[model samples]
Target chain A: MTYCLGIINQLGIVMASDSRTNAGVDYISSYRKMFDLSLPGERSIIICNSGSLSVSQGVLTLLNRDIQNKEEQNLHTLENMYDMARYIGNKSREIQDRDRPWLEKDGIDYSCNFLLGGQIKGEVPQLYLIYPQGNFIQATPETPFLQIGETKYGKPILDRTITYNTPLEDVAKCALLSLDSTMKSNISVGPPINLVMYQADSFEINRKLELRIGAPYIAKIRKLWEESVRHAFESMPEIEWEQETNDSEEDIFID
Target chain B: MTYCLGIINQLGIVMASDSRTNAGVDYISSYRKMFDLSLPGERSIIICNSGSLSVSQGVLTLLNRDIQNKEEQNLHTLENMYDMARYIGNKSREIQDRDRPWLEKDGIDYSCNFLLGGQIKGEVPQLYLIYPQGNFIQATPETPFLQIGETKYGKPILDRTITYNTPLEDVAKCALLSLDSTMKSNISVGPPINLVMYQADSFEINRKLELRIGAPYIAKIRKLWEESVRHAFESMPEIEWEQETNDSEEDIFID
Candidate 1:
C-alpha cells in the first residue's frame, strides 16, 4: 500500500509519498512512490503514484526509457503538464493491456493511479490526478489536493486545511501532518517518505526529503496532534440526557 | 448505509449512530439504527448497527420477542457484558442464516455489524463490535472505540486520541467530531444522529438523544473542528527538499 498526496497552490505544487509495500504481514518491503522529472529552467513535473507497484514501476521505466532515447514525445518534449499527464496515462494503459489477461488469471490487478503536478514554462503550477486509463483532471480552486492510495484516512485533514490561497510552506506542513495521521491509523503506509515542493515558476523543487526511521519531527507531530484532539473534545458541550423512549423524541427541539 | 460508533472509556460509554438507509440513491428513508433496552437499576443494552438493515432489524425484533415472552435465556439472563456480546453475535448469525440464500442469489451480501455497549448487573460499562458472522470482540484499552459502516473515513481521529484513560465526556465529543468528519467526506452517512451514554456501575444508560439538527452546538463544533485541523497543520514543520535528480533523466527510486 502507498499514501501519496499532491497539492497545487498559487505558489507551487507540493507532493509527498510514503515508501512501504507488503504482500502480507511478512513480505513488507520499501518503495518510493514519488517520481520527479524536470527540464530545468523550462518545465518541471512531479508525480506521486499509488496502487500496484509492478505496474507503476513499469510506467516509470517506460518514461525513463523514453527520456533516455530523447524521444520527441517524452515528458521533456510535452509542452505542458496536461500532455504529460496524458502521456503517463497512455503508458499505464499500454502496460495494463499487455498484462490484463494474465493479471486476471492470477487474480491480480495491473492498476496504478498518479497525481501529476508542477510548472511548465508558460504555465503556473498545476496538479492532476491521473487515472489508470489515461485521463486526468487538474485541481481547481474548490479542490486543491489530490490524494491516491489509502486516501480516506488522511482526507479529513486535507479537506479542512487546504485552499488555493494557502501558503506553499504551510502546504508542506499540512502534507507531513496528514502523513502523520495516516501513519498512525494504518500499518501499510509507513516511513521513510518522499516529499517535494515546487515553488511556482522557480522550476526547482525547494522542498524534498526522505524521512526515515528516527525522524524526530514525526514524534512531536504525533504528540501535538493527540493533544489538539483532546483540547477540542474538552471544549464541546456534553450530551444532555433527559429524553426517554416514551417522551416525544422531539423533546430535543424544545430544549 | 449508516455510521455507528461506540467508545468505552474510564468515565463511561458513548455510542452514536446515523439513521439513513438506501436501496439505491433514490429509495432513501430514515430508520433508527439505535435501539435501547434498559431495566432501570438492573440492566441496560444499547446497540448501534450498520449494514443489511433488514438483518439487524430482524435480529432486534427477535431479541425483543424473546424478552417479551419471558424467555429467561435472553439478554436479561446474561451475567456479564461478554455473555451479552456472545448472545447478540449468535442471534445475528441466526438472523443472517434466514436471509442469506436469497441475498446471495441476487449477489448482495446480507452483512450486518453492530456496536453494542452498556451494563448489566455486576459489570462495568462494556463495549463490543459484533460481526455479521456471530463473532464479536470487546474494545480494550489498545483500541477504545469501534465503528461500523463506512468506517474508514472516520477512523483516524479515534486512532489518534482514544486510549484507556480518555474521559467519557471527551469521548462523546470525539465521537461527534468523527461523525462530523465522516458526514462531510461521505454521502451515505447522515444526520440527525442518535447519541447514548452509560455511566459505569449504574447498570443503565444515563442519557440519550437525537441530536437536534441545525443546533447551535453542532454548528459550533463543526466549525471549531475544521479550525483545529488548520491549526494543527500550521504548527507542524515545513518540508525540506533534497535535490538528487538531474533534469536529463527521470527520477525513479524503485526498480
Candidate 2:
C-alpha cells in the first residue's frame, strides 16, 4: 500500500508520496511511487501511482520506454499538462487492455490511479486524477488536490486545509502533515516519503524532501495533531445530561 | 458505506455509528447502522455495522430472530459480551456462507464487519470486532478501541487519544468527532448517528444519544472541528522555501 497526494494551490503544486509496498503484510518492501518526468527549467511532470504494483511499474516502464524511444508523445514532448495527462491515461488503458483478461483469470485486478500535475514550458501548473480505464478528471478549486491509494485516512486534513489560495510551500507542509496523519493510523502505509514542491511557472521541480521512518517532523505533526484533537474535544460543550450545567437540579447521570 | 467505532476506557465505554447506505453512487439511502439491546440498570449492548447492507441487515434480522424464537442464542440470552460477540461473528459467517458465492457470481462481495461493545450484568465493559469469517478479537489497553468501515480516515484520533483511562463520555465524544471527520471527507458516509455509553458496573444502557441530520450539537461539532483543523494548520510551522520571495517569483506565479 502507498499514499500519494498532489495539490495545486495558488502558489503552485505540492506532491508527496510514501515509499512502501507489500505483496502482503509479511512481504512488505519499499518502492518509490512518485516519479518526475521533466527537463529542468523547461517542463515538469509528476506521476504518483497506487494499486497493483506490477501494473504501475508496467506503466512507469512504458513512460520511460516512450522517453527512450524519442517519441513525440512522450511525457517530455507533451505541449501542456493536459496532453501529458491524456498520454498517461491512455497508456494506463493500453496496459490494462494488455493485462486485464490474464489478471482476471487469476482473480486479480489491474487497477491503478495516477495523480499527474505540473507545467509545460508555456502552461500553468495543473493536476489531474487519471483512472485505470483511461479517463481522468482535473482538479478544480473546489478540490484543488488529488490523492491516490490509502487516501481516505489522510483526506480530512486535505478537505479542511487545501485550497487554490494556499501557498505552495504551506501546501507542501500540509500535504506531509496529512500523510503523517494517515501513516500514524494505518500500518499498511509505512514510510520513507518522497516529497516535491513545484513553484507554479518555473517549470522546474524545486526541493525534494526525503523522510525516513523516524523523521522528527513527522513524529511532531502526529503528536501535535492528536493533541489538537484532544484539545478540541475538551473545548466542546460538555454533555449537559438531563439538565443545564449552570442551574443543575438533581440532574445526576443515571449511571 | 458506514463508520462505527467504540472504545472501552477506564472511565467507561463509548460507541458511535453513522447511518449511510449506498447501492452504487446513484442509489444512496439512509439506514440506521447501529442497534442496541439494553436492559436499563442491568446491561447495555451496542452493535455497529458496515459493508453489504444486505449482509448486515440479514445479520440483524437473525439477531431479531434470536430474540423472537427463544431458541437462538441472542444478546439477551448470552452469558457475557464475548459470547454475544461470538454469536454475532457466527451469524456473520452464516450469512456469508449463504450469500458469498452468489454475490461472487455477480461480482459483489457480501462480507461485512460488526463492532460489538457493551456491558453485561456480571462482566466489565468490553468491545470486539466481529469479522465475516465468524471470528472475533477483543480490544486491549494497547488498542482500546475497534472501528469498522471507512475506518482509516478516523483512526488517528483513537490511536492518539484512546486509552483504558479515557472517560466514557469523552470516548463517546471522540467517536462522534472521528465520524464527523470521515463524513466530511467521504460522501459515502452521512448521518443521523447513534451513540451509546456504558459505565463500568452500572450494567445499564441508559446513556444513548441519537444525532439526526441537522441536529444542533452535531452541527456545532462539525463546524467547530473544521475551524479547529484550519486553526491547527495555521498554528504549525510554515515551510520555508529556498526560492526567493521576489518579484520574479510573483511574476512567474501570476502567469
Candidate 3:
C-alpha cells in the first residue's frame, strides 16, 4: 500500500513513485520506491518511499550508511533542503528505534514515510514530508505538494492541479496523472512508476522515468487521461431535473 | 466522518450522502445522513448512514422500534431486498450489542455502516452494503457501487463511471460527483448533500435532494464540475518532451 508523491512547482521537483510492495496478498513485489540521491553537480537527493518495506529498507540502508560512513549528518553532508529533511528524519527515527521492539513481537509495523526531494549546491529546489514521527514538513509557496503513500486516491488531481506557478512539464503531467489515479483506485498501488524531474537549478538528475504496466508513455497517459475524463464527464451540466421540477413548483407556490 | 453512496443503475437507485457530524473539531453538527423508506405502492427504503453517530442513531432507533411495534420482522415486515438487508444487518448488530460495552469504556467508537437502497414489491432494484459486522454485501452486476464513510476520496468516480448500465440520470450525476469528490478531499465530509432517486418499477421515491452549501442546484453542480475539470486538464495530450528525447536517443543507440 504505497503511492508516493512530491511536486514543488515553478519549474522543478516532481518525484512521484509506486512500485507495488506487499507482504500479504500473496507476497507481491516490485520494490524500487524511488531513491536516486543525485550528485552530478553537487547534491540533488530524491527519496520517495512509503511504509514498512522493512522500514523502507531500513531507511535506505541507513541512508546508504550515511554516505558510506562520511557521516557527521549525511545525505552528502546536508546543508539545505531542510538539512536534507533533518537527515531523512534522523534516519527514520534511527530505523524505527532499532526495529520497533522486534517488529512489535511479530505484529510487524515498524512505520515508514518519506518523500524528501532535493537541490543543495546553494539551496532552492526543495520539498519534504518525512514523518513516521521523526517529524518534518517543508513544501510551501502555499503547499506546493508532499505526499507519502496511498495518499487519498491521488488527492483530487493534486487538489485541482497543483500551483506555486505550476509547469515543469505541467508538474510532470500532474505526476503522471497522479500516479494514474493511484494505479486506478489502488490494487496496492502497483506499477513501475518512479518519475523524478528536478529542473530548478539543475543539479542534474536529467528527467527520469521508469513507467511499466503497458508503458507506451503509460499507454499515452492512460489514453489521454481516459479520453479527457470521458470528455469531461460528457460535458457535465445535465442534472436539470426540469429545473428541479420548476424549483419544486416554486416551493408549492410558497406554501 | 461520513460519505455515503449507492448507485445500482439501469435507470434506478442512486442514494448519496454527506451531512457532517463530529464529536471533535469542537463538536460540529448537521445530521440527516439520508433516510427515506418509501411505502408508496409499497416499499422503497433507502438508509445510507456511515459510522458511530451513536451507532447510526442506534440503528435508526431499533429500526423505528420494529416499525413502531408492528414487529414480527419490521421495515414493513421485510421479505426481500435481502430481507431488507438482513433487517438492517440485524438492527446493526443489535445496536452494537447494546452500546458496545459502554462505548468501549470511553474510548468510544461503537462502529456503524450501511447503505441498503430500495425496491421491494416483487423485488428487483437493490443495493445493500451493511457491515459493522452483521455482514452484508449485495451490489453486483460487477459492482454497481456501494460506499460508506470517507470512502477513498470518492472512489475514482465510482471506479470510472459505475455500470449495471449506468443512466438513472447518469447515476444522479455520478452520485453528485461522488459526493463532490468526498467533500473536496474530506474535512470530515461535510455539506447538506443527501440526494436519492430510485426508479425501476417505480416503487416511488420520486427523486429527492438536499444540497445546501450555496445551493442553486449545489451551485450549478459545483460550477459544472469545476469547469469540466478545468477543461479536462486543458485537453491533455501534451507531454512530448521532444519525443522523449528521441526515445532516450534511441536508448543510447541500442546500448
> Which of the two, 1 or 3, has more TM-score?
1
Write candidate 3's Cα lDDT for A10-76 as tens digits: 6788887888988888988988788776666787777887888877787787777767777788778
True-vs-predicted CA distance for residue B4, candidate 1, Å: 1.1
* Candidate 2 accuracy as lDDT: 0.79
lDDT of 1 at A142: 84
Higher-scoring candidate on TM-score, 2 or 3: 2
Worst 10 residues of 3 chain B by lDDT: B246-255
Model 2, B64-119: lDDT tens digits are 77766777467678898888888888889888888888899999978889988778
lDDT tens per residue, model 2, A1-255:
789998887678889999888877999998888887766678877788999888888888898888778787887777877888888888888888888999999998689999998888767678999998878999888879888888877887787777789777668878888788778777788798878898878876766777888877777776676777778777777653432122211211111
The positional error of residue B61 in candidate 1, measured at the CA in angstroms, is: 0.9
> Interface RMSD (Å), each candidate?
5.3, 8.6, 11.7
Q: How does each model score on lDDT?
A: 0.80, 0.79, 0.78
- Compared with the true structure, what per-residue lDDT tens digits does model 1 show for residues A37-78? 766777777877888887888898898889878899998888
lDDT of 1 by residue, B54-164 (tens): 788888877777766779767777788798888889889898787799999999969899888888777777899999888888888778888899887789888877787
What order do you get sorting by TM-score, best first? 1, 2, 3
Clashing pairs in 3: A3-A150
Instruction: Order the candidates by lDDT, highest first.
Output: 1, 2, 3
Residue clash pairs of candidate 1: A208-B241, A208-B242
Best by lDDT: 1
